[model samples]
Target: MAEALREQQLCLSRFIRDPHSNPAPPGIEARRLAVYRQLFLGNMQSLLAGSFPVLSATLAQTQWQSLTTEFYACHRCKTPLFTEVAGEWVSYLETRSDLPGWVAELAHYEWIETVLLLSDNADPAHDPEGDLLDGVPLLSSLAMPLAYAWPVSHIGPDQLPLEAPVEPTLLLARRGADQKIHFARLAPLAHALLVSLQQQLLTGREHLDALAQRAGVERGALERQGIALLHGLKAQGVVLGTVRG
Candidate 1:
């Protein structure tokens, strides 16, 4: 009896996962299987659609449907939570060869906003008014740096690029005190500085010196420019403040 039940479960699982290719278990009504398939796949489609609205908008309806169905059929999601399905979809894209090269990057960019929205990271304790150059700069726990090869930030239904740009896109997504998420395009220098700050090992002055050396500029001039940039980031709530030490 146990072996029979196990076989039945396996057959049902295969049918539900890929109804088009897999036959239903013996004695199961076709209509009943169809209802189950529709319910399960529809829910998955709706969840992914909500999570990746921009990707959905960029693709043709048939393409989107085909992509989602492929994901549903082949991707064994790592998490049972509905909120994480979009993340799973992003991962699934990495294994696919038929889709456009930019699709994965675009889906990941959309997923970052969802991740920031649901992040439980709290504001770090720091002096908001502290000097940015003199002390170590502390990046907000809610902000993240992202880089993409295909200008994922600019891609949409009307703005899809057929070829990758020469320069990669760098962006920062930061959640504000009001709980609103904001995205900012960053110059390569600004993005590198923010990444340095995130490491939490370098003081603001050290970062400036390192950046100056990389750019082969005078440290004093870079320090002046770096301070201005840090101040602007502080105003935008991306850099929380300087550490006491």
Candidate 2:
């Protein structure tokens, strides 16, 4: 009896997800089944549209509907929460080769703001006035360094690019103290530094010295410019001063 009930539930769910492919559950009214199918797919589309407005806007209405419908029918979402539905869609897009290659990257770029905003991680204890060079520079928990092949930050309804640029797009996505999410372009050096900071808990000067070595530049020259960059990051709240000793 339990197995039969489970099978019925699966049939109903599958049909609701893709009525065109999956047969309607036995003994259910066609009218009611259509309503259920519409409700489920419509809700998923609406939720994804909110999360990835840029992607939704860039695609034609039919394209967007078809994309969402395919995701609804084919993707297996691990989470039941509406907030996570966008992430699932992004993941699903990554696996799809039929779609444009830049589509997944664009979706990820737009979805980043949602990820940072929903994160419950509190800021780590740090000094707001400590020296960045002398002490360890602490990046805010909300700040994320992202590198993408597609120029996702620039892609929109009217500004889609046919091919990726020679240089990869590097971005810093951070949630500020005021609870606002912001994105900024990062230079190659800055991107590498932030990525290194994540991997190592070294002082700002030490990180710069290592960076200079890697770049085959004079340590003193790089230090001057690197220190200024570090200061600017602190000003933007990306570098939350220094780690509290």
Candidate 3:
């Protein structure tokens, strides 16, 4: 009895996740079940794909179907509620080895925007708190900084090319101080710097020095450049808050 119940649960969830699958069995009449199953899958797919249009575009119909199938199968999403599905879809891609690395990053890049826009975090607006010279911190309230070895930002089916550009670009995606989500192009030096900050590697002069050593650039040069980049981040609303005095 328990096993039958489990099967029913799996079948129902599958039907909900993607209605375009194998037909329902003996007792579940195809007529009414078909309406619900197809409707459920269509809506779920549309919601998730809309959020990650580029990823959706890059994948073939089969690939997208398979990817989402795997997502529903392996990932135990706490919420059976449909809204949480997209977030879990992105999470599964991140942890799954079969997913293309670039695809994973692209999925995440897409997911973060929706997640942030819908977030309830009460991180009130505050002026970026320090002098650029003090090696102050910079970040956006809705702007969660991400660093990727794969150039996921500039990726599309063919248009926004994904090959890691020889020159790395820092990506700052944020719901603006004006309540708009904005995307910024970042320079390599600046990308590296923000990455450092995101990873807790650089913040003050010490953070700058560490990155400078990695790049083999003069310490003084990076310090000057760091401050300049700091100013630029604030201008773009990338500066979220100070690292704390």
Specify the highest-TM-score model's number: 2
Ten-residue segment with the worst summed lDDT in candidate 1? 122-131
TM-score of each: 0.91, 0.92, 0.75
- Candidate scoring better on TM-score of 1 and 2: 2
Cα misplacement distance, residue 39 of candidate 2 (Å): 0.8
lDDT of 1 by residue, 1-245 (tens): 99999999999989998988888899989999899888989998998899899999999999999999988898888898888887899999877887888999999998988898899977667888887887888898899988898988888999989999899999999887788888889998899899889875577899999989998989998888899999999998889888865
lDDT of 2 by residue, 151-190 (tens): 9988899998998899999999999879899998999999
lDDT of 1 at 146: 84
Inter-residue clash pairs, candidate 1: none
lDDT, candidate 2, at 212: 95
Inter-residue clash pairs, candidate 3: 138-239, 138-240, 139-238, 139-239, 139-240, 202-207
Candidate 3's C-alpha runs over 4 A off are 1-26, 80-83, 124-129, 135-138, 160-169, 201-203, 240-245
Q: Sort the predicted structures by lDDT, highest score first.
A: 2, 1, 3
Worst 10 residues of 2 by lDDT: 17-26
What lDDT score is found at residue 14 in candidate 1?
92
Model 2 bad stretches (over 4 Å)? none
- Cα lDDT, all candidates: 0.88, 0.91, 0.70
